[model samples]
Target chain A: MVTSRDIAQRAGVSQATVSRVLQGNSRVAPDTRERVLAAMRATDYRPHAAARAMKTRRSQTIGVVIADITNPFYPELLEAVSHALDQSGQRMILWNSAGPGEYSALQAIREGSVDGLLFTTVTEGAAPLTEALVHEEPVVLLHRGLEEAQCDQVVSDNVAGGSIVADYLVRAGHEHIGYLQGPELPSTAVHRERGFRRRLHQLGMDLRPELVGRAGFQHDTARTLIRSMLHEPVPPTAVFCANDLAAFGAIDGARSLGVHVPEDLWVVGYDDIAMAAWDSFNLTSVRQPIADLAHTAVQLLLERITDPDLPVRHELFTNSLTVRGSTAHTPLDPPAEQRDSHADD
Target chain B: MVTSRDIAQRAGVSQATVSRVLQGNSRVAPDTRERVLAAMRATDYRPHAAARAMKTRRSQTIGVVIADITNPFYPELLEAVSHALDQSGQRMILWNSAGPGEYSALQAIREGSVDGLLFTTVTEGAAPLTEALVHEEPVVLLHRGLEEAQCDQVVSDNVAGGSIVADYLVRAGHEHIGYLQGPELPSTAVHRERGFRRRLHQLGMDLRPELVGRAGFQHDTARTLIRSMLHEPVPPTAVFCANDLAAFGAIDGARSLGVHVPEDLWVVGYDDIAMAAWDSFNLTSVRQPIADLAHTAVQLLLERITDPDLPVRHELFTNSLTVRGSTAHTPLDPPAEQRDSHADD
Candidate 1:
């Protein structure tokens, strides 16, 4: 283990000069920087991370708290974030919050292990943890938003996404459509519900309470809920799912019941995950600008990490509707129209 | 900040006793342990992670190096590993190895910030950084096996899985079959190829060079390669993919070319990922005992962490075939007979 002193001695420079060159300080001459780097390579000098952290008071690390990586959507977002962070030579320490509670998340926040935090909580109310993180370091919320907390957030326009689905459904001549909502507390779920309901009212269509199903953002729960929805005295002709996972469940449920998608019923999902494009699902979904959201969140967090006094920023990217085979048929189609007209409101 | 001294004073115990109780040494009396815990809670005393590391010579943290989380297989493995590590009161520090080179991963290992390393490398070659980890700390290789390195490894039997698929294909009376292979260098890929070839030879069949397509472990690349295979002068009646993602690409490729799955051609994939059961793919794949692999890796790593003198271990788990609609056809079908007659070796 060669030290800075050893490198300095070998390069015929002072230890301070070696440190400056290693840190890429502007004060160091280009020739000196090259010499120091060459000496470091030759000697295999590895800086002690703990010592560096003590000296600079910076770990050059950020914490990413994701609810679940099993969900394809979060991984895509993580990939983008990791790529952006790597560019700045900053490392991301990932923590999975998929367990029973937020205890681990809070533990990570209070330890002062990271310079900043990027949290994607499963629920909308994480005020205590949010406050704790804010007190210790700059916090940026991604995907899941907290309504009561005033924090920097980067999320897709879920409300507009829901409304866009409604618009597409209505244009396809579906008047009585059901909504499969995610967990009640997640802000994205609530906003999407609001948008769906508002658009339904605007279209002069009544939303039937029986037509709605709420799942805790899980595939099995969504499947059970959707299965029951189909068995109702009169099922809605089209169903709008809260997320891609739930949408997949609904599709599976329909298949189990021998219901032909887009023929007997139309299914639409949000968050056009990579699987949505597979030949199996071909799911019609609202594509969240995930890459844009990742870029915005990273940029915002970087700004805050550099200068914590920067005003809190909220970036809401627009969503787009990707039409696929699942929602291909219009309600005007004879059999589908008949099913739509006889549907209970 | 309240320290152990405060807790000792409040609990009427010595500082050593308080430290012992906090460390869960199990030698302390229950009453004294409870008193110390209550006093510490009352005083809001939180242990400093850095100080603890200095005393214990352990960070109580493990580094997990994953190539990509967006890949479904990696997340499943990560979740299991995280859960197992959490039960032992250890934290996992994630390092994404999706960068250009192994520099970042090597930096993490050389720094000694973590107690051990769990790596999931994409490339088959033994990286210099991996060798360094083996020499420096307790290293566990997950999924991807290294041929050169002698270290603890936990992997599903890819060779057995490949053989299972070959057996199924032969049982179904498919004489002409295509094999979609991943990159050549990876151990898993090599093992799968060996198993598939051996099983085919045992069944009195020889692998046709033209029927084998090579693609990196990526869906898009597999899609292109599989498309070309489907357009061959005389396409095989059944195709065995390297993994679920590639199987999905093959399914999509077949659909794009108006080839009906299980009707015109059969498709079987390895690694029965979550998406395999989705309404779209419904792919017949070999189920990798993920939870077992995860638990085994964690247990092996912990043993090494506890005592570095432990010998390196390699655990192999058996894989089961999951039959799905993708390859539901039987040999008695007329299409199978036609395919057998058209086979050109």
Candidate 2:
């Protein structure tokens, strides 16, 4: 069988360069790419990458499992990952794990169709994750992570992000504040909430249980939860959401009840997604370096794929707060009429 | 070699049921699923689906190529496609063709990694697409079509959608109108612009060259273009954007220039993305039934994959106009103050 080595020798190029030319990758210089193609044609060397995979057990493909594709955050992360993989001459196959697609991605790994798996969102102790780990397939976690799993992980400082929001809200003179919690499955939610509660406690403040609402990382759920919270006898003057999507929901829900944001109820969110900058939302959020996180995670996965025995690496990226119109105004007490009307409800 | 057929015979089930169980598909009944698994265990059958594919040449994977994954419209469309593929127990491998990912997807097809290809966006008569067709591959085009291609296609009524927007604007008493056009490569842009121009002509109106701006379905590009258009000697009272993303940019741009929508100008968008309903935007847009379109497109691709000789199918879905705050107010003449300000420029 003719191999890339033979083509490389014929074209006077390295084996890696030959592989890049085979991928139709643009990184190859024009003259070198022509030489490789001419060599392949002259030798009648058929390009059957799948057939080669059976011999070498490498498919040059990676499987990416995302929580929800429609979520703006995932797409931004996915785009970054896609570009990084393209630079390395690898293909990406996606699975929307929010549905039944997770198992399919696992099956792809078992069938030797992908070199490794990169999970952007995964539940701790998921069966599929455990199965992949037991088999020693290359795995890397990004953004949302599992603490118990022994794999390469890339995460932003969620705890610090949460603490910063709490400090900002308190210093802005929000005497009464609410919290919108994300689902408890992922570490992101757990750490963010932990830091927020811890910081509030240190400051001699209490987050009354009645003022806290729990929801998945979704807009509609947060909206509904905030609406009910606003009806409490002593409603909160501010609300901090676990993520940007929930913050949008909270703002919309508050608007539906005729409550003005920042003036009546300040809102802050995490993950500075692009929509946060839109004139509609202008949401104050904690910004994670998504492009940096994505690129580093892919690099880690590739490193593990090449050397499975290397030491496990956990990368923690720092976070910053982006203050926008949502939390730009100083806190104001709820109007007497609004507070009295809530008592009627 | 222990085949699923052998397990089916022992379990008193059909071969299809065994295949479903092996795939971990949820469509099988609980009792039937248990019996199938037991039979496989009793026979000591190891699941090597890749080995089976080597024989049957069927991987049960589909390649999905999308243009610009960050665009809200693509994700909405992708979620629908992911759900449809999940139901059929087929894996979806995604490629963002906005970069160099398209060639990677074609390579997958060449290596028999995917059973067929589904294109959500493509330029007319592209080289890679032509290569796929030449190889007798099962290919389907969704939302974009090529007149010279012989593959199955699924698209919405872009021409009618454009006409509807033109009629709505004309009826709103707007004398001067503008158009924010999409890229010239895709059929969606061409047909939409053609329909809008034709309708305007029938209504005894003309779309002057100075009143039109072309961009590649992006927010920032449209924003820059609209800022310049607003400086024209006779600016438009209403602007019809090719897609919702452009409308957002147009609205943001006009606001930056102190031009209030509907009072000084009206903005309309297409694709009715989820963001369109946000209170910040509340943009009037043309709504295409994305779920229906995605499901039908997948069905066509699967049918072609199954038979390879089925008659070519082209499905066209209809679109509707969603009126919202962006165009809700009465069209006022470009205020005298605004016109005077532009003249000073």
Model 2, A169-264: lDDT tens digits are 766656678999999787899989988988888877779898898967788899899999999998998899999999999988887898998667
DockQ each: 0.51, 0.51
Candidate 1 CAPRI grade? medium
Interface RMSD of 1: 1.9
Regions of model 1 farther than 4 Å from truth: A1-48, A98-102, A133-136, A329-345, B1-46, B98-102, B329-345
The alpha-carbon RMSD over the true interface for every model, in angstroms, is 1.9, 1.7
- lDDT by residue for model 1 over B1-345, one digit each (tens)? 788888899999999888666443445788898898889789888788778766766666777888767768888888888888765557777877733434555566556456777776645555654555556567788887776677788887888888888888886777779988977776778888889999999999887888888866677777787788878897788898888888888888888788898787888888898888876677898899888888788777766766677777888899988888998754234366544643533
Q: What is the lDDT of residue B48 in candidate 2?
A: 76
Provide the lowest-lDDT 10-residue window in model 2 chain B: B329-338
Q: Which candidate tops lDDT? A: 2
